[model samples]
Target: MTLPIEPTAAQQAAARVRDAVHSATVGLIEREQLAELIVLAAVAQEHLLILGPPGTAKSAVVRRVASALGGRYFEYLLGRFTEPSELFGPVDLRRLREGVVETDVSGMLPEAEVAFLDEVFLGSTAILNTLLGVLNERRFRRGHTQIECPLRVCVGAANALPDDESLAAFADRFLLHLFVEPVPDHQLEALLEGGWQSERAPLAHRTELSDIDELSRRVPLVDLTHARGLLADAIRKLRGAGLSLSDRRIVKVQRLIAAATVLAGRDTATDADLWPLFYVMPTREAQASAQDVLRDSMSAAANPTLRAAVEHAVLQPVSRAARLVEAARSCLQAGADAPGTATIAEALLREIDANFDAKSLPPELAAERARLIERVATPT
Candidate 1:
């Protein structure tokens, strides 16, 4: 008989934190990508940027994840007229009288473990420099003094990418740049039903700071040699396609890939771990090309059968939609007078919708699914 293996301490901790954080933000519709990035960035001790318009639950997602991690949270919305004192804290008047210059550094970004800056690129030049140092070096420095920061990850949200070349450096500080959009039409009802629930109830289970600290320490220890060759090839392809990835960013990304491996309870990083690279493009225009390169890379590295299965599901959605419709109709007919018939039909509709998003199906399939749902929903 084969023996069963137990999970390592690091694996257990990673799973615990992942579950806690995911459960805390479950109310946000179609936010699986955002949640995964949040956990990955936190475990890697790197920053993230969410690019989307206002009211996309960008701030809510970060705030909820931070709350579940039981960390000191700081959030600010920057505007053209914003001042450094608003984000960094005010200077100490008493200290100035004694011939010293110091910001209080209390209850501000400098002291926060998880910080969210909405409209992050709107800060003035002075605040921009200070913010960059805090993000890149994890240290806050002022005239003649510097202090270490406890920031695990800083989440920034912006309506659009910065147009000025001067802000490129600041933009590069966040290793992961995820694009979030409003929920699709099909998910709107779920969004309305559950979105407010997350705001009202706090997460029951909390992940202590020590758990994240331990995970960070173990992330770099995971082996990356297995995927090194594939990663190099992907990097070449990205650069050949007009994307610029700095050496520092490349090194940082290794840590993120290793962190993802650890989260999967593996000691060796695999080609699949490179999926996060899709979001690291330096420019918005480069995202589609980068995605294509990364997807092709992943497909090349994946098993042939698995790749074909994914392609079939995504490319041949008509067959799958027909199957789902048939299933729903059968259930409704069998349980015509049963109380659970409507519930079953609703569940099938949700599955169809989820699969639609997963496969990026055509509008025709979506229309068919809607018609099927309506037929099943109408009383006999």
Candidate 2:
């Protein structure tokens, strides 16, 4: 397919960039799951919760990642013995005399852009409460002032998912849940051979916040029409399978796709970028739920009849809209000599977009939807 603009070196460099990032982070874990963890952490622009026993290289991996991406780093261990003041900051004494609590935002959660909170569930109420706002709203309020922490990602290291009710809300805020284990027996020799620690300098991959902001800017512009159906179908199937994840995850997955596309310097998302799900899939029990969801989806469904119904219900309108866009481009490029130039192009685009709106499938793909309706209804 021809594009209006030639694919530049940035576009050509996607795989190289991805591979470098992948290789840089791979040795820290025993399996590819950790790689997926890093990808999700990057794309979702969300924190990751690593659940495993100690000595799994959780901090090492996160530290290597921060070094590679070049984001600010803060690491702290949370335990019954942990202190809130250590993780956040010390309150200002002079301000306290003036009936004000002034705290310098310079520690683990506040000053760092990408953070590593070890033993996250063991924190006291103060830290957990502060974390709730940091993870959810991306802001930390102290005294009468709110601190907007420029967090690219936060990595929480836990021995396992917390069972306590008080911590569950904070735990749930982590969008990606990954199980990290010690290196395999075979890989241990290599681990020993390579030395016990990762050689990655924290600043090596430290991407400027502006670069991330630019990636955010580019992602929403990416067209994901082709993959949208598959993603939606996956979500519906996961729901049907009784996965315990919340609806908020659907939004997170969408954002992950967009970010992945941007990092690839692409204008649209596709199945190639779907691998990031390995990180974001909910629980160990739900890995099957995720696999089941994608098994048929990424493979192309066996139910051709149902697939056709889906295509007719979803793909046809997008196809028409794409054609309309192509036609509009041609008309506009004809230098005004083309017949009905502006009006014709506008009318076609408007109709296609109008049809695009009218073309969404029914939520319940019941018997009625299985049989194509004469006209497609617009997506709300």
**Best candidate (score: lDDT):** 1
97 in model 2: Cα distance from truth in Å? Answer: 2.9
Local distance difference test values of all predictions, in order = 0.73, 0.57
Residue 252 of candidate 2: its Cα lDDT? 75
Give each model's clash number: 0, 14
lDDT of 1 by residue, 78-134 (tens): 999999989988888889899999988889889999899999999999999999889
Could you tell me every candidate's TM-score relative to the true structure? 0.80, 0.69
Residue range 171-203, candidate 2, lDDT tens digits: 778877777567655444445533333453222
Q: lDDT, candidate 2, residue 174?
A: 81
